[model samples]
Target: MENANRGYERLFGDDGLTVGATFPLTSARTTRPNVGRELALTERLEALGFDGLWARDVPTDWPKFDDTGQTFDPWTWLSRVAARTDDVALGTASVVLTLRHPLHVAKQAASLDHLSEGRLVLGVASGDRPPEYEAFGVAEDERGAAFRESVEVLRAAWRDAHPEVETRWGTLDGTLDVVPKPTAGDLPLLVTGNSRQSREWIAAHGDGWLFYHLPEDALRSYLDDWNERTAAPFVTTCTVDLAGDPEADPEHVNQGFRAGAAWFRDYFRELDAWGVDHVIVGVRGDDRERAYERVAERVLDRL
Candidate 1:
């Protein structure tokens, strides 16, 4: 696949590793964060040496799930981030394709890609939230198929003029076309999670893979499995709570780690050596700016 998008280039490459950050960049245990403050922090992303910024698509607040995923619409929030920064790739950790119309996603993603000058890399997924399925009138069991359809639609809508497509979301005849095609002609679609699809299916379809954090041994195994299927890039999410002590040993936290800079440096190196292309860092600290600086100085620069 042709990766002409700047964001795709910034995030994925050969024999290299880069780091990005996710929203709710601070340790605010709330559904929402201060938008102005967050925007200000975004302006400094590239200056801080971060390569990308990620947003999550949380259609609604599911208290049981307990994560608001930045508590803003992913498209709107990313536009704001795009306006404030230059160069850093803007991404969705994974948009819930099952809940959205693929044509709409295609238009919005293409528009953002242009507005940001080809700095959009969409990570798409079949949603996992059960209640959201009911709310959106989407069948939970059929999300896998819907996800595949959405991916197909998005690619067609972007690459072809007035492309013909037939799916559960209705048909797009060769009459009207979605305008403002991605600057790269096609955007990079990184499949998130299994998305209720077979590993072979994901490998064949996705331009890349967005996976969650795993233990070193497990990650190496997963990478090996992925390499056997395809040579596409692999990205993972890592949530870290940086300690005050530089040499502090890592203590596993929820889905991530509470560790110091020293531990993270070693961990990132291992990931790089394992052929992991990028990591979307979710900082779990009160002072996100300080934590970002620490990682930049102690981990990223050294790498």
Candidate 2:
């Protein structure tokens, strides 16, 4: 396994606009997955020169959310990926921070960072899973505060040898400690969707941002406003179902688009011009292998 903190450099280099692929290679709705195939594709993605490999955290099955991200435990799955790949950044697209204890989150995140040789970018959120609140016994109103506390605790836990923090997740006295600190001694805590916190709060506390796909015009305006407020990198996601015809124009899909590789290059170029730092794409096709084929010569080769 590699043993260096290159995750940050790999994602945010002097050059701009890196690309990554999201988990669940196939859009299979069921919770079960063909782990062997997913791993194979992950290795392929790395070999193909994608900058990162993003995994999702879905602690429980919540159909309303519409997607079962990878259908595997984020920690275990990412650890396996880290061991398999040589140097692709390992990330959690958005871990529901409020639902789990911050200590446990810190421990797992730190461990993954080490195993990946400091290639962990933790994307976190207060959680949008409504039923999970009741299941985890976390009150809805308390989630925002809980989210803030979790971020603070995670940062402290990874850095301070014996951090003293008190929150709804429980108190961490200076006497106690969590082991296996991050390989870099820090994890880029990128907050997703504000988590019901103010933009000011997000800018102040978060190391970066992970937002949903927005209209190009709105995105430009939003980025300008955000840039004026903070220097954080603006990150987003796209679901791509590349058309067989490389010259086809883009048509709207859910939070993304269905287009040809030619359109994809221009689309991504537009994002780069608009100041987008990185994009995590969820490939959509007839199957996982077909999706890779569509992206290979058509997309990656051109880019």
Candidate 3:
């Protein structure tokens, strides 16, 4: 963990599971906002003892995707979040690296990390939305290579004063530099999913892995595979819509479960047992406020 960020260490500590929040902190999936409410919720989440505050990168309003992802440019959004919060780890649940230039990403990520006082956790991925790829004029088929190249550039820019990297994206010939290095000197790069790269490649390049939700057995199997590949941390997103009953059993809901606090606590314990280092819990429901309170009371407090 050389050059590790303190906030990151708080969020994903050495040997235990931690929980974090994803914005806009409500169940809404569209592009409109109660910006003030969201910010207030962020402060409240940190006070409630959440380890991290995560933002997503969705460059456009792709109708098919449905999820608008907090509907803000991540750099601006995260810098703003950084100012308003004191202790929570600031993260991109992931920024799509394929659509963006590496130099721009490096500069912006470093800036945010500095602004947040080393709280930034850079979650990155290749472009996933087909329409987004078309709009960026990048070939979807070439994204795998593009993603790999971008990772190299981001790392080089942060780790070296004048990074000279030669890739199809372009060369950083050491003539110029991406300034404002992260407080840790180099920020952690948590690769989101395979990103069209092999598991081995992720193991070699990424500091950690952020995966989508899968069943317990499936996630365990995947973690088993990752254990063979590398010793990096394993992270996953869980969209929770907590039930009213403490003893309610789990029912399926959009890559997560609709379970009561009793079941939810037990389920998280199960995930922890399965080597899931952290979970990005996206609570979804009409009564998100109630869910939030209940989460801290019955679920998080007990955990």
Return the top candidate by lDDT.
Answer: 1
Once fitted onto the true fold, the runs of candidate 2 whose alpha carbons sit more than 4 angstroms away are: 1-4
Ranking 1 against 2 by lDDT, winner: 1
- Clash count list over all predictions: 0, 0, 0
lDDT per residue, candidate 2, 1-303, as tens digits?
Answer: 122367767887646788888888755465777888888888888887888888888888877777787889999999999999987888898899989888999999888888888889888998888898999899998999999989889978988999998877788889999988888777888889879999889888877788988888888887887788787778898888888788999999988999989999888888888888889887765577668666766776676
**TM-score for predicted model 1 compared with the true structure:** 0.97
The true-versus-predicted C-alpha distance at residue 90 of model 3, in Å, is 0.8
Candidate 3: residue 34 lDDT (0-100): 79
| Candidate-wise lDDT, in order | 0.88, 0.83, 0.86
Off by over 4 Å in 1: none
Q: What ranking emerges by lDDT with the best candidate at the front?
A: 1, 3, 2
Off by over 4 Å in 3: none
Query: Residue 51 of candidate 3: its Cα lDDT?
Result: 89
Clashing pairs in 3: none
Task: Find the 10 residues in a row with the least total lDDT in model 2.
Answer: 1-10
